[model samples]
Target chain A: MESKPPDIQLRRLDDYRWEVPQTGKMRTRGLIYATWDMLPDIRTDQSIQQVANVATLPGIEGASLAMPDIHWGYGFPIGGVAAFNLTEGVISPGGVGYDINCGVRLLRSNLLRQEAEPILEDLVDALFRNIPSGLGSRRKDLKLTTPALRQVLRLGAAWAVKNGFGTADDLLHIEAGGQIPGADADLVSDKALDRGRDQLGTLGSGNHFVEVGYVQEIFDEAIARAFGLFPQQITVIIHTGSRGLGHQVCDDYIKIMMKAAAKYNIELPDRQLCCAPITSPEGEQYLAAMAAAANFAFTNRQLITHWVRESFEQVWPAGPRALGLELVYDVAHNIAKIETHTINQVTKKVCVHRKGATRAFAPHHPEVPEAYREVGQPVLIPGDMGRYSYVLVGTPQAMVETFGSTCHGAGRLLSRHQALKAAKGRSILQELAAKGIVVRGASRGTIAEEIPEAYKDVDNVVEVVQGAGISRKVAKLHPLGVIKG
Target chain B: MVNNSDPPKSKSGYRQLAHTADLGFRLYGESLADIFVNAAHALYGVMTDRRRIRGLECREVVVEAPDSGALLVEWLNQLLYLFDTTGFLGREVEVQEITSQRLQARLRGEPLDEERHQLNTGIKAATYHNLEVKETAAGWQATIILDI
Candidate 1:
């Protein structure tokens, strides 16, 4: 870990925003969106220093930005966002993290909380059984050949739909229509292909989960109505990402980028931040491979969504359509996209990197699906299983300031080891049970490592983004049951 | 023949470190080859109980890199790929040759049996964040972070 600078300087812009002045080799400043309550904890870590480090990258168009859920990660701090000029900027895999399109997908149902409460245990068990999860999780039934897997890499969620995992309409609600353009299966390595072959429809371990929840509170009735959400209505949230396939894609490219960085003579503050010019061959190949891995993630989630619906059907003895289990929206949290943003009143194309952040494009933005054009894109922020998760809408302010990005989730406050130590004697499952939450996990240690106390209060994190006017609250979902990998 | 059940009796081993969002392991060894072997052990230890894995199979892996850091990442990623694709676990790793630029190793283990092994965590890949292999008073030390 990088030693914390003794005197990390900061200028408070507001109660919800702080700035680290440009100094040394920094091309721009560092901006952190957080409240005073979150600053003390955020400052204790090295993430703020990462923000400063990012500001020094070549061709960084704006300040290195971090959402309220900032935490220390490998190169770019988790929740970090930075935009690079298309012509002059560089593309770093570290900025996108290991999980290429690690994201969240929310599903709304017509069933009421009261109606599902009695069968919550059975439902959770069915989900746990139906969804292959935990370490080394693979589906025995859905193994894909190299040829079929290539289609998955190229088509993403659309591939899953075509394979009878979901409806064609489901693709419309997904980011990038479930398949990012420019993905080339040829760019992916055989190692990645082998790793991803049997892993589709499986929920890999560590913080990835499927939670059964209900809309417990509504902040904006009109927007909530537009989002197809109502009080006490059941919902499901799937949190996962590209599995080993994406990891290998990133691992494969990081080596290539390291050489490319040296070849291009781009000075890197950290080796993990290795990058190449946007138009370089190395950069283009990495983007294509990353998109293919991202498509794998999209297809993985779509397959899981199908199984989730099946689990519900088995328990309730009713079809998914009868249960109204329709997809709300799917958004990628860890990704880099080519977008046009106005900088100093000049609209320019830039590669926006959102690591541990979500794109919150404003209403009427061409990227916003026509179905949600009036109320804006739905931003899903999943908190720890024990606390409430939130649904927020994108805002014009986000487009203006953040290059259309916002916080992803409640950031971690404790290390896994620390959480393990704190949970030594307590039965985390029992504790959750007392709160009327049904919880099932592949391992007890995983449950302990993910205790609610290990994460910052997501409510505070959400408040900062809303207070900053980058996102507006819509409804809050309370968990009833959860299945963790 | 190497007895896979017996753990490497090396003064230099590995220990888990603290990271807010991912897993970090600090490895130490008396020599560069020892460090490479121990790093493999550390990785397998993180995924499952290494003792239960038998040395019924052996596979040779050779990787060449421009530097030691990238070399280490490539080595670990090779092991990860084996596990991910074929459920091959390394009970023991014997470094036949080691240098800053290249390494040749014989990995001995068997396919993972769900009923026989208790799997712990799935590591995505080894990262280069603050990655360095250096000589210490104790010999050699390296710190690697794994994205989980």
Candidate 2:
């Protein structure tokens, strides 16, 4: 209710970290991982106050944490991470964001940039055409019956593989094998189902996009080799989520949680932070429904991957295997996963909420795919369409200090209105074209709103996390073409 | 003093508000019914070009919530569901009866014709972030943040 920013003191923990000491009703301290230079921009918004607000949540295991890419968000600041005790903690839909399991999936192609340069425009067009994008984007031909849609909610990417969208082996590189256990279709409301029914393969509007890029640099050769990424190698990144289904799920449950918060006597500082105890019926149901929506997102990405592969085939006339179109890895940025972590020297299972953050499990973790077990989980951080995105690997430091979490993407520096005003007469498409990147969007308005100036330089965000030892950079990707929805 | 016999019809309208990451709108009206109608209008206005849309058909919408705030969220989400499922965009919404607990209305618009109307953005859902409806000296006012 207060528009004025809260006056809070930040004690410098190090060059890359800051701390807000436990005070008042806060159950723990608030920790933010960002450089001193970043703090100036970060402090301009109320996200720091939000970090402190989150510390007041009951059963919060570690300090309420924020990654370097932190920015103002509804309940939790974007890039916020918090782990809560399973029995005593609460689940807030806002923590996972409205786009449940909104994530990134990368595909490695053996084709070098030189090999694809001639066909870059054709490839971009093919992708833009094959993959439905923009507002109200849907696949008219891929309509699913209610039962089939339920199976998608239950089986996730495996359902897509079974339906010939992709191969079963592709599932190995996906987080949680692309299917989270305990997802119950029965928990998903009919309205949620109806909303997602035709949206399975769509690249919905706003920041969602499909990028065709090439590995421009490599920081860790060993890890890069493991990920099948090499300098000059082509790759495709699909960024989307559960579409309308996830939105409705969060919307529906937020109302329930608002009531549940009152019913459970959980005092919410902000109404958007509405939540319930993890063991309560309301919490359990929300988790079940959220998992279902997450599965839908997984399947949605898998189907889009198939289309991306098809687009490549159409352009090259070479089989996918020959082109070496292998899935590198997929990571969900918005999600709540029950994971085991050591807290106070005790291995305890807790629900880790990552809103605008990614899981960066350390090397040798059981959850990391077998191929990547020797290294760490591959974390994808997509930047604005005009700039370079990074590939990072998890570290033990991340596991111990931040519950194995890292920044999701470049945090916004300018609001949409500001971006639009800045881009009043300039041609955004031309600006990107000058940078050797071909771009397409549903409308010019979205393009103007997403100008590169609207976001913080992702390079700085990545540098802060790497400097803090939360995640190690693996590779950098330069976009050759982009399709925005 | 202004004439009290005919109070100038308080303009019912809405305007987009600046948000760092998502979309926000502020709506105001002379009465609760006017604000509800304007809210629907503003939502559709953000999604597509309302000028291109014609009121070719109508559908009844009925929803109930525990309070006015939740009712507003439910009302907009219901419209989103209709758009996602049946491609129905509300060119005009007439509120027949509205209370804190219940809302009954008729939404008049044709199914989305991509060729005729240009969509601006896909709104996921109306959020509860600072969602509030209050009576002010001028009239009724509500602010909604949308997750785009």
Candidate 3:
């Protein structure tokens, strides 16, 4: 075990929370929502200081927040959250991450554990075949014309449905109804568009996965019914994002934003935090481009969803009716959305950037689907390959503390190289199979790097969020099979 | 000048050179006239065998970077981007000019004679993590990291 680093100043607020105070160069306090047990693990990361650095960003409204799953990433910590005042605040690409609108969506099926168990292998193989998973994997079927692709960027999931991927009703459960306003595909560069063109309907590698699982436990009976989840019922989770297209979009803009920051004279302590004012010409261009990439991701997932249903149809004949697959809710983990919040009891509109964070708007928010209006928004948290994933709901407390954000996953405890090194002697797939999980991937090294031992105990993370009441649990899921790139 | 190792001499006023993965080299000529001319060759060394890359004949290609870092990332990313987007791997490369502001660069390359990029795992773009290009005591030093 590596000894914890001594540099970060961690203070205990209670048994379940820790805080990195407003020390030097900090505009606001650095808040970490981890318990004492997680402290040693947290100490191993420089991301704690990154939280403090993010607090120093101009026009930052709330405290720079790190959830229990906090881990080091390129710019913002993987599980970091922050809300900036729209009028004076700034927007950074680091805050939204390179994968624009990378997110998780849950689909429920009527088949229970026993019914799905017999054909699980066939179903898993079907899913693996239908969706391309690997580095630079592209779909041969869905090539978009320039105008058609631009329209997809403008409409997002709505476009996916309009093009007959899924029904319009599926959009109701999606955050922002599947289309975030003001996404300008024209803002995306040709390189970004070119990279994105071939990647649609594919799952790009490195932490992107599609898991077949079942509801292991139900915490809220009523909410569970509303979410279409039940104990022992099988479910499928799709975890992916905007693919290379999103990455290229971010790359193209990081340069644009840097120059824009200089042109506007925006002082940046870290160039990774380099950004234009939210209302500036440079910032506007980025927002437009970012939204365009986000839309591409929505369409990508939408196309994948159609293939998933097709996969079930290949084996089960009547197209998932005999299997009973239905949509639950899809939520984005990396995105910046304009929202209204009550700051000092006055409603103010602000842009909330969630990087490796999930949005948790409370029940009855105009954006949530009508069916779930009373149960709140469904917050899907995918833990890791070996352990349990969760289905959560947005809460009133979430709006109060975190601008309605929650942890995204079981954060990494080791880098891919470190994990691969540790996994050198072990057969990760065999180990997972021993634990009753059937695993498949493009390469053995991919399995090694994504082994379950490389992460924190997600139960600890879920406890923190539940204790914080930012998001409440609905059901827990255990993975049966996983496919990765 | 003191007898210390320095960067290369350019037609304009930038240095285009090569280093290992630890510290990537970039040349910022600020004049669009010189951007890709320096970036192309700087990236070629990482993708192909430096010896082969050094031996290539001129095949003109124009490149651009939005700013200095973007130009730096784009210049490097374009080389990797070539390997992924196109199979035209390089054996030899030479960038004749570089510009930073409007981002322009030119380069020449021969077909694949090496596959050094296989050591990496599908690096999507060169990132700006701990990146720098400064006038050091030994002339100028540039650093970059490619995100795999």
True C-alpha contacts between chains kept, each model in order: 0.67, 0.72, 0.13
DockQ of 3: 0.13
TM-score for chain A in each prediction:
0.99, 0.99, 0.96
Ten residues in sequence with the least summed lDDT for candidate 3 chain A: A1-10
TM-score for model 2? Answer: 0.97
Model 2 RMSD vs true structure: 3.3
Q: Model 3 compared with the native: what TM-score?
A: 0.85
Cα RMSD of all models vs. native, in order, equals 3.8, 3.3, 6.1
Each candidate's TM vs. the true structure?
Answer: 0.96, 0.97, 0.85
Runs off by more than 4 Å, candidate 2? B1-11
Per-residue lDDT, model 2, residue B43, is 88
In Å, residue B101's CA in model 2 sits off its true spot by: 2.1
lDDT of each: 0.90, 0.90, 0.74
Chain B TM-scores per candidate, in order, are 0.90, 0.91, 0.53
Q: What local lDDT does model 3 show for residue A288?
A: 84
